[model samples]
Target: MRSHLLNDLTAEHYRRSVTEGVERVAARLATTERPFTGVTVDALAPRVERIDLDRPLHDTTAALDELEEIYLRDAVYFHHPRYLAHLNCPVVIPAVLGEAVLSAVNSSLDTWDQSAGGTLIERRLIDWTTARIGLGPAADGVFTSGGTQSNLQALLLAREESKPGRAAWEEGASLASLRILASEVSHFSVKKSAKLLGLGQDAVIPVPVDQDKRMRTVALAHELERCRQDGLTPMAVVATAGTTDFGSIDPLPEIAELCARYGVWLHVDAAYGCGLLASVRHRDRLAGIERADSVTVDYHKSFFQPVSSSAVLVRDAATLRHATYHAEYLNPRRMVEERIPNQVDKSLQTTRRFDALKLWLTLRTMGADGIGELFDEVCDLAREGWRLLAADPRFDVVVEPALSTLVFRYIPAAVTGPDRIDRANLYARKALFASGDAVVAGTKVGGRHFLKFTLLNPETTAADIAAVLDLIAGHAEQYLGESLDRAS
Candidate 1:
């Protein structure tokens, strides 16, 4: 039974297995022709379902071969030039190395006893990120699974802080008449967080945005005043640093000043634009992030690090105590009193991964300025793409992007109706994805479907975007022609 155990269970066996797997992945990535294989679930499901999990393959080599066929063969390649889908970035090499090292070590970052060096390294990275945001000396943070978790934790802190007399953590205590004010286009997580915190979805007041898709400051002020009139406590105002669809950054300076005037917690959801902290050229775009009570940063999005590398930084470190818990066996009160840097004191998760290592290695190998330059490259590419799209008569593009995303829709000469145009754009997106020619994203604006190009890859160029645009136009034309033929 001992001999039949997993290869990764032992140090020597783990090294051999991991090296082989990494080599195979590297080779596959280099040779893969398409960004996605366009393998349907129906086709792959039977093949995977046929494999009996009860029977174990004794040989690691044989298992690896089977795994490649079952998974790697159809995996979407983010590094591909035409992968203009979501906010996924082509990860840096140093971050990949860090992922490999951290997974092998399997260090749990909850307590100092479990991860001494890992704890310190994560703390140092937090400090560095805090300073980058110009958060004052008392700023502190904790690494989270991703932006969703970071946002959730930030709201949780706000909820705890908003309570009046007895702390929310205290026995027999209840919540207040708390309401979260956020842009109508802000991340869905704000509403989800509200629900999770027992505030219900209706507690989130959706403030209208301007024509540019940015939160209208006047509208926000109106909503805040309305909340007061309704006897609802405006607990927190979530200002989006970078919205998902339009990449439009809310008026953070104005939003921050409003929050200060009302004494409301300002939670900046900078998950998508936090990379600007390192951008020497575009850092000014995130002007009032320092004034935020808490800010969420997803390093994986723009910092070019792997997934699960994100943090929620607070302006006041004392606010972190809201999430603190003292476990007798894990992070005991004695250890915390002794000034031990137990990460569990701040994090919502008890057993957290050392995801900070990825960002640390990335920063160590490629300095902050280099990372910023990479982000700037993508932003530059987006501007070029925007110009190309706007100049073309075949498409209706939105306003100039604030970050590295462009929203547009194919508008053929014959398709004048709004419904027809929406169908054409949706059809084009699906057709292009199914053809495996190029992968792109779509979102609805004013109930009309629009294609989105979230350009996070610095390697993607104007030529690549131009080619993708051509493909999209071709698909849209094909769809329109088919629709006309059906009508005739």
Candidate 2:
């Protein structure tokens, strides 16, 4: 038993594994590696040989080799320059190393006893983030799997805060008295969270945006008055720090004021735009985000971390205690009597991963200012890209640059109809994605489809935008121009 526990495979094996893996991947990272990732995935899907059903785990080296081959060969690398599909992109080195250490410890952070040191680390990060947002000095938060979970947690907290001692989870909720206000351009996750929280889809009140996609405050005030007159409870008012479609920042000051008057919880879904808090140049876009009762920020999207690193932060710490369930074995009667804190109190998950380490490591190594500099660089680049797109007569940018997102599409010189602009944008977007040479997002603006570029990559340059625009122009000329005739 002693030999097995302290086996010859102790330090040497661990060192060798990580060393070899890093060495293997380093050359690939260094040379700006390129591979036909999709084709490789298809080829290897049916080609890799697996052990027979009777075989047990064996030859760990063989397993590692197979996995590494698959990773280098088939991985959809978000780091690749031409790999712009979604908000996902390159991850920083410090956080990558943090993931390794956290995995080795394999700590479960539900209770203080389960993760004494980890609790402190997470607490520190939460406190730092909360302070930056100008939340309550006593505000607290927990790492979530991603933005979806963060938004759900925020809404759930708002529910608990609105009606004291009424557990939304245990007693559930009725939609007849519930209404959540948000922009039409808000993340789909808000409506999904409302439905998941038992509020139902119809409970959401989507206020229209002005020419920019920010929520129209005048429209929101009218809706709130209607709800009040109808004797419905206003659950929460959600503001977008950076909307998903066009990256338009909502009128946060106006929204926060409305919420204060109506006594509704103000929640900010800043999953995409939260990093701007670090940017001196662009921080004005999110000026009143700190006034929110809760904020959802995805380190994965904004801070260049791997997926599953995000948080939902509240202005007060005790509201978390309201969401907790006490178990004798975990918290224990003695500990509770002594007033000890547990993470499971605030989080929706049990047996949660030590995801906080990644963000913590990043903050320490890069410094807040370093990350801020990177953020400012990207925002500046996005503006430059937008300017270039707008200058081209063939493409019309839908809105002015707000954050790091750009919405524009191919506009033909001959198109003269009122709806022709939108019609052209829609076709150009569809044609570009159908070929899949590059993937840019698409959505309807003012009841018309508009193409979007979610520029989260700091290394993405004006040339990349030019290339994509060229694709749009070529596709539009081939498909739209001939089909619509000169009248368009």
Candidate 3:
């Protein structure tokens, strides 16, 4: 057990162990043929459950051999070209190197004492991002676990800032009257954050989106006026830069102006679209994001970084005081006067991992332009996919993609019934997943089932998309033919 610890004394042992693990992963990556193994849960669960955890394999190679069956053999490979289901991206090499270094050092980014240079590195990265967003000199932020935590912290700040100065109301009344306006297609985290903040169930009002799935600015203005007439406090307006299913961006300039006129806090949830910040060609897409009071960005989604890399930036640094607490044992009031920078002072989490290193190293090794080019490639690929879907007679595309996702459903020429079409599309997606030929995602649009392709992998070619479509058609036609035969 003592030999297992990573320190100066066991440097050789640590290096050898890590090298072996990396070799195993490299081999798996080279040999994996499909995105998934198509292994059923029922068959795989028993093997994992029967493993004797109490029996420790002393040798690293032996332990790895056991791991091959229960974990690696069944793991979903996101790097595969056919993995067009989710927002997961294949990570860059420099970021993976950063992950290796940060994990071994084990720096907790709570205070200066825990993480010395790590603190400065994270702060510098935050400053670089805020500058990219044009958040001004006073802008500040902290790294969070993901977009959800970032949104929660931003809303918490909004809740405190919306308090009435002329009159002191009961705590329950204040919480009840607060409202958050977001597009109906916005991420579910807005509602979850409201619940966590002890707000009423109806605190989040669903603003309708246009056919493009973007929040209608006219409807948003109407909602703001309604809130005023009804004597409710409009705490914040969450403008989504890229919706999950449709990749639709809300009208940012209009929404920001509305927030200014209404004096409401504007929060732009740009988690999926933040990669555009690095994209020279597409940076103009996020035009009015600079006017937002706070913004949430997830580098993991588009920056080709690993998971758990995201930040919440604010235009005004002082607003972060809402999430702060003075603890003598950790971060005290004396440290503030001494100008000692403690990251925990503005974070919702303590003992935070040094996740910013991944992005830092990624930027240093592959400059912002390098990251941007990769993102642009995927966006261009998505446009090509949309064109293919639109021209095809067998599919019905909902809307042209604004970012990198396309939502469409297959329609059989003979299938006149809507319900039957829905069932066929559903069957096709699951069948594709089970066959391990390709992986796709499904969602409902206007009460009709539809399939989605989130093209985050630049390696996924147009031919792969065509092949997957053919596979889906084959599976769907098989099911529909069997159904008709049974009915006759």
Candidate 4:
């Protein structure tokens, strides 16, 4: 790792590796011929020499063969289009290459010396993304591991902003009664974040939702007033740009106004839905998103980057400087004199990776509009897929796609009993995913289980959707016949 020896692994290695990996992935994506999961460790040692593993990380050195086999053979790769158990998809080539190059260097990114030019690159990317979200240029942010960390950091910031005088981290939040507000449909991570912040789970208020499952501002105002009467302080309003369950978006403009009126911090958790910022059409869906005190966006989710590329941008850049730690060796006077924006200043991480490089490289190659177009196209494809499913008699479209996710259920006419139909749907969904045959999992809506198709892959088409539907219907028919014959 010496400065002189640094040139040994040099730029040429990264360039060649990037070219090979990207071309391999790009070519493989269309065919769906890649193995679904990694093999066992015991079986993979003979080929262990093929994969990359650094020497500094050696907890698994003894089990390298086993580890490599299991990781390569069993890991559920998000890149595969059929692998839709969660909100993930195939990462584009440029971003993947960006990740590869950064890993080769293994820069810390805590300070200028650690990150070199990465500090500037991350800051600029943050500025670009923040501007799109309607925040001013004064905004600043940092890349994080994923949505959970970003949400936690945002909540921590909200606590600090609301209680500037109180030492919440050390003394653990004062006599002030803190409460967190989020829609009923918001991600569970919101509550988890609040609890982890020492705000307590009881402090999280689950506001009522409209028919579409968006948070009701009227209910929120009532809850705030009720808390006021109870001597509770309204800490922050956690608005969801896209609810995880049905992609329901809490009314952003109205919530923003309510937060402003109450002088509460507005934190938008758009981890799943922030890609709408790229969309000229759906941008209005996230209206007033700009006014948010803080926003959480994951390049991993909407931007089609690999896992662990998340950013939390704030309206005021100085709010980020609040997290700054003045370490002498790290943030020396000379470094400060140079006016470097330490990536650590705005991040919860001490040794952060260069996640921005991917988004930055992706933007440079495809243009921002290209990403937006992908968003719009994926959303529209979800709608078309819904229509195709709804037209068929046996399959039921439970919810029209709110974003790119569609919830559907198979209710064969033979299963006339409501309870029976519910049981059948749940079983079918579980079985399909467990076998990894056209993965569609069950989600509860209105106390009933429905199979979900979260189509983030732009390559996913009507044909793919139709194929999944046929498999589901076939399973439903087979199961239903077995059940009826058993009864007879």
Candidate 5:
């Protein structure tokens, strides 16, 4: 136990153990041919269940070897070009190096005493990001676990800001009266946040989106008017910079103008589209993001940082006080007088990890332009894929992609009923996942089943898209044939 402790005396031991682990991971990555092994849960679960946690493997190499059998062999590799399932991106080398360093140092970023230089580094990064978003001089934010927490914190601030105004307007304005207007297609986290904030079940009023999947400003205006007429507090207008399913960017300038007119706090959930902030070619797509009262950015999604790197920025730094709490043993009230920078003063979390170091190292090594270029490649690839899906007679593409996601479904040439088509598409997605040839996602658009291809890897090309389409067609045809045989 003494030898295992990570101190100066055990530095050599730590070095050897970590080196061996890195080598195993690198070797596995180098040789990985597919995104997945298509291993079923039943087959893999028992191996994990059989392991006794109390029985410790005394040697690092032995533990790693055992880990290879149950975990590494079947772990889905996002770096693989065929992994077109989700928003996960292949992490950059520099960010991975940062992860290694930060994990070893184990710095808690909640207080200046715990993190020292790390607190300043995170603040500088926050300043850099807020400047990029053009949030002005008073802009400030704290790092969060991910976009979910970021969105939650943003909504929390909006709730706090709205409560006083609403209470003054009416006798008893409670959480139930607060309404959050957002697109019907916005990320599910918006609704989840509403529930967690103790708002009413119907607190999230879903605004209609256009054919492009972007929110309709006219409909939003109607909703705002209705809320006022109903004596409801229009707490916030949650506009999505990039919707999850369609990657559609809502009309930000129009939405911002409406929020200003209505005096509603504008919160831009730019989790997926924040990459466009760094985009050389598409920065204008996020033109009115600067007008947002609050913004959520997920670096892990588009910045190519590892998981759990996100932040919530505000135009007014003072608003973050809604989340602040002073403790005698920790962030005491006197610390403010002493000018001690405690991240917990603005965060919903305490004892937070120094996740900012990863982004810092990544920016230092590759710069924001490098990240933007990589994201641009994926977006460009998505356009090419859209063209392929549009041209192909076997598929029906939903809409032209605004970012890096394409939603389309297979359509058999024969006169098949919509139900059969739905089943065919669903079956095809499952079959492809089971085969491990290529992994794709599935969603329902307008109550009809559709397949989704989220191209985050720059290595994924037009050829890969073409090949995956053929595989899907083959699988769909096989399913239809099998269904017909069963019916007969």
Candidate 6:
């Protein structure tokens, strides 16, 4: 076991292990067809448990063969054209190459000495992102695990920024008086961040949204006024760049004005819409994002990169000190005083992966304009899908999509009641998933079930969406007929 370890002493063994593993993965990618096999946990758990890790196969090929049966075969393939379920995107080739290189090196980006080149690469990427965001000269950011962590860190900064003179580090009393105002349809992470930061869930005040699902500026103003009247401090105004369920972008300019007038920190969660940063045509949709005090961007969501690539950027570089802690063994005070760039000073994680390498390689190979064009393609496809859904009688399509998500419910002519229609839609979605033909998502609006099509794959076309819609209609009709038979 000691000889098999990836230490300097076992360099040859480590090289052989990695080389064989890459070959197997590449072969699997070349052959895989569908997005998912729809294997339930009950069926997969038993088979996976049969693998006896106590007895090492010793041979990489044999180990990979067994691993394929237990894990890879059932894994969801984002590259598949029909995988329109969530925010997952098909990864670019260059990013995959970066993943391979980063994994082999295993560079921990927390310290300067441990990851000398990796730290510089990550900082360069962060600088590039801040420039794209137009965060001005004082902008700074740190790569996070994902959007959730980014949101968490952004809120943490906002909390600290709201309490300037007080010792916030030792006290939870000031946090109780602080409130975070967010759109009702904003990502759930805002509320979760509040809970984790010692601000009770009740501290989150939900601002109403208009019919298009955008944050209503008038409502936000009223809420802020109410907070003032109640002697509560508005710590942060969280605006969604791309909401999860509807893909609606809030009116950022209006929200920004309100935050500015009220002197509250504005944090924009752009996890789903950050790709617009590179968009040639659709970039203006994110107007006034530059006014935000903090912003969250998830590359994995819309930048066609792999998972675990995101960053939280702040307009004021000084705000990042809130997350910094001096460790004697790691990023100590002396190192910082000497002007060393240690990433862990701004990060919540000490053992962070070199995820920025993926985005850097992607930009170099694909070019920012090329990536933007791909994002434009998906947005165009989404509008086309909206037209298709609106023209069809079976779907009660909601308002026109602001981005790449369509939220609608199946409404068969024969189905009269809203309750019955809700049941049919729910059943249809489950049946479609079980059949493994096309994977779509589901959500609820106004307490009624609605099916969703989250189109993040540029390869997916109008015809693909049409086919999935037809499948959904067929399942819904079948469910209705079955329900009628049972009633009779």
Rank by TM-score (best first): 5, 3, 1, 6, 2, 4
How high is each candidate's TM-score? Answer: 0.97, 0.88, 0.98, 0.86, 0.98, 0.96
Write down the lDDT of every candidate, Cα atoms only.
0.90, 0.78, 0.93, 0.77, 0.95, 0.90
Q: After superposition, how far is residue 166 of candidate 4 from its true place, in Å?
A: 2.6
lDDT leader: 5
Candidate 6, residues 207-303: lDDT per residue as tens digits?
Answer: 9999999999999999999999998889999999999999999999999999999999999999999999999999999999999999999999899
Higher TM-score: candidate 1 or 4? Answer: 1
Q: Looking at candidate 6, what is the lDDT of residue 23?
A: 79
What would the per-residue lDDT of candidate 1 be over residues 348-400, giving only the tens digit for each residue?
99998899999889889999999999999998899999999989999889879
lDDT, candidate 6, residue 432? 84
Candidate 4 lDDT for residue 263: 88
Please identify model 3 stretches exceeding 4 Å from their true place: 164-173
lDDT of 2 by residue, 130-215 (tens): 98888978788988998889998889888767752164446764445788888988999999988887775588989998998789
Worst 10 residues of 4 by lDDT: 56-65
To one decimal, what is the Cα RMSD in angstroms of model 5 from the true structure?
Answer: 1.4
Give the deviation of candidate 1 from the true structure as CA RMSD: 1.8
- Residues 1-488 of candidate 4 have per-residue lDDT tens digits of 34223366555654554566555444545554432533434555556665556653442233444543445344555666565556886788889878887887788888887887888888888888888887886787888898888888888878777753256655754634888898888888888887787765587999989877789999999998988898787788999977676777788899999998888989999998988978867778788899999999988888888877998888887777557777777775565568876777677788888888889899999987888888888889888988997898878776677688877788787637877788788777665655555666568878887888887888777887887788788777777778889999
lDDT of 5 at 225: 98
Q: After superposition, how far is residue 463 of candidate 1 from its true place, in Å?
A: 0.9
Which model is ahead, 3 or 4, in terms of lDDT?
3
Q: How many residue pairs clash in each candidate?
A: 0, 1, 0, 6, 0, 0
